[model samples]
Target: MTPAVPRPASRPRLLVVSPNRSHLALLARRLGAEGYAIVTAADGATALGELRRSPIDLVLAELVMEPMSGPELTRAIREQLAFAEVPVMLIASRAEADPAVRAFEAGAEDVILKPFHFEVLVARIERRRAAAERVASMRADMKAMDARAAMKAIELGELKDRMYQLEAERRRVSA
Candidate 1:
């Protein structure tokens, strides 16, 4: 049998934020090997700053962190101007489902348990990223249209005022 042809991989820019140094290192290495350019942050504060300064396709945040937790970070990210639709996946070792639910409520697109299967995690991340991109693009277009409409309203108001002034001047001259 002929050897199976290997498919080329699409490298996605992913930000991996975790409070645990060892876990972060392992995740960064694994994801990087799987055709993802990994950016690491030790805490939510640093991750938020990095995300603002750079373009990130996806975010993987650990649920437990000092200073700020994953859900809190996700909320902050959602509040940002350009990143409202950016996909986020929260990671945690806790078996309880409440944290995951909380993360989703706080704006995380999904939650993955630690020691996650590689293929599953990658697939979920890719899907969320694509969906987020589509949503963000639509939102930007809508915002542009809203801005144009506001400008048109301002212009119409000015025109009406000008017409009234001209009518008043004509009446004064005729009288």
Candidate 2:
């Protein structure tokens, strides 16, 4: 019996943060062409600002940067209640340097090595989003079940009350 709550807009938005200028643009351009609403930032500070300002569905950041690194950004994002479900991926600049372990510790979904295929990035994004959507659907289903259970409890209480009244009436009639 609760009023309908207006849902947030469903647009898929991504924030790409990197101190490197070249590949950042490439990612932005390609991902934008792929129909993502892209937001770009040069560092984690700017990215955090953008996250606060808009509804970002995903984040792609460099593994290392100045003023705020990928791990810092991931930690900050995770600390916020609103961004808890948002997925973050960190891109490493060197093949020999794998930040996967540290990135995971910082709450990043994955660390992408340099020279990664754009297709792989897109696939990861798709999988993350699919999993998130599934979780959201499950939460809604749970809420409905909880409400139904509460209503059933109320009905059972009323039925028991009626039964008790019927027994009392029968006893009085017999007496």
Candidate 3:
């Protein structure tokens, strides 16, 4: 029998939110075909609910929606400590230059204008995902380093206490 091969880890999970159901479904299908695990929401409220339910690696939202727009959703996401670091990308039409600017101000990492190439969109998503992964890795490394530093500080304190005890004993014996 041939040896079993190891499977690669799961791809990133993406949350795609749009007011248009057909467009949302199309985007989900395309992204899914690209090997990303996708979750779609028809509006910001539903998207937030999904976010509260599970972890999402990235959020791609439409610029305009009822009640809550892409920038509004981004702000809400940023306000939540749990998802503050998740990268948010907004999709806007060519006419939405103003709102696109607002998206950046509201903490969107990237905004892709409509009538864009599929390849370009894919490239942008890949770049953002890579950056997010690097940030996460760095954070983990920093946490590990902090733990080591803390442990060393504790060791140093213990050693100093022992040294003080030894000095006191010597004084008592010498006396």
Candidate 4:
């Protein structure tokens, strides 16, 4: 038998948080087709539980959920280090005054109104993933730089010790 081809990895995992079953199903179906591994949560608390259980690349939440609002969930997520870099977007079920501002201030990256275009939603998700990848790449570079600096510092210390030994030898010979 021919060797099975290895599959490429790295598809973004998305969590969709909404109380409405139909809305959740629709998002899961569309986004899954768009290449995201979809997970559903009934509310903010459930979303957080999912985050704790596994890592999520992005969060799409409904603005108005009972008990905890989307912004509140975003704040909670931001507080956790594992979820801090994950992109969060809020969707409003109804038009409200300054909902976008509220969501942004609370830590959501973007807010979409009701009846948003599917294309726009997919674009936003992709953009968020790209931005996150950039940030993670920068962080990795910084770590590598830091490691190099540490190694150079160690080498300099060793060089100084060798120089001290040479100076002592020279003094002894002169004596």
Output the number of the TM-score-best candidate: 3
**TM-score per candidate, chains pooled:** 0.72, 0.84, 0.93, 0.92
Over 1-175, each residue of candidate 4 has an lDDT whose tens digit, in order, gives 1222232486779999999999999999988877788999999999999999988989999988889999999999999988899999999855687889889999999998988888888888888888988999999999999999999999999999999999999999999
Model 2 bad stretches (over 4 Å): 1-11, 95-98
Tell me which of candidates 3 and 4 scores higher on TM-score: 3
Off by over 4 Å in 4: 1-8
What ranking emerges by TM-score with the best candidate at the front?
A: 3, 4, 2, 1
The digit string of per-residue lDDT tens for model 2 on 1-175 reads 1222333456589999999899789889888777788999999999999999998888999989898889999999999999988889998866545488779999998788888877787878878877877888898999999999999999999999999999999999999
The clash count for each model shown is 0, 0, 0, 0
lDDT of 1: 0.86
Q: Which of the predicted structures, 1 or 3, would earn the higher lDDT when compared with the native? A: 3
Q: Write the per-residue lDDT of candidate 3 for residues 1-175, one digit (tens) a residue.
A: 1222232477789999998989999899888877788999999999999999988999999999989989999999999999999999999998865866899999999999998887788789989989999999999999999999999999999999999999999999999
Quantify all predictions' global Cα lDDT against the true fold.
0.86, 0.86, 0.90, 0.90
- What value does the lDDT take at residue 34 in candidate 3? 77
TM-score of 4: 0.92
Candidate 1's residue-wise lDDT over 7-97, tens digit each? 3464668999998899889889877777787999999999998898888989999988889999999999999978876788998777756
lDDT for predicted candidate 4 compared with the true structure: 0.90
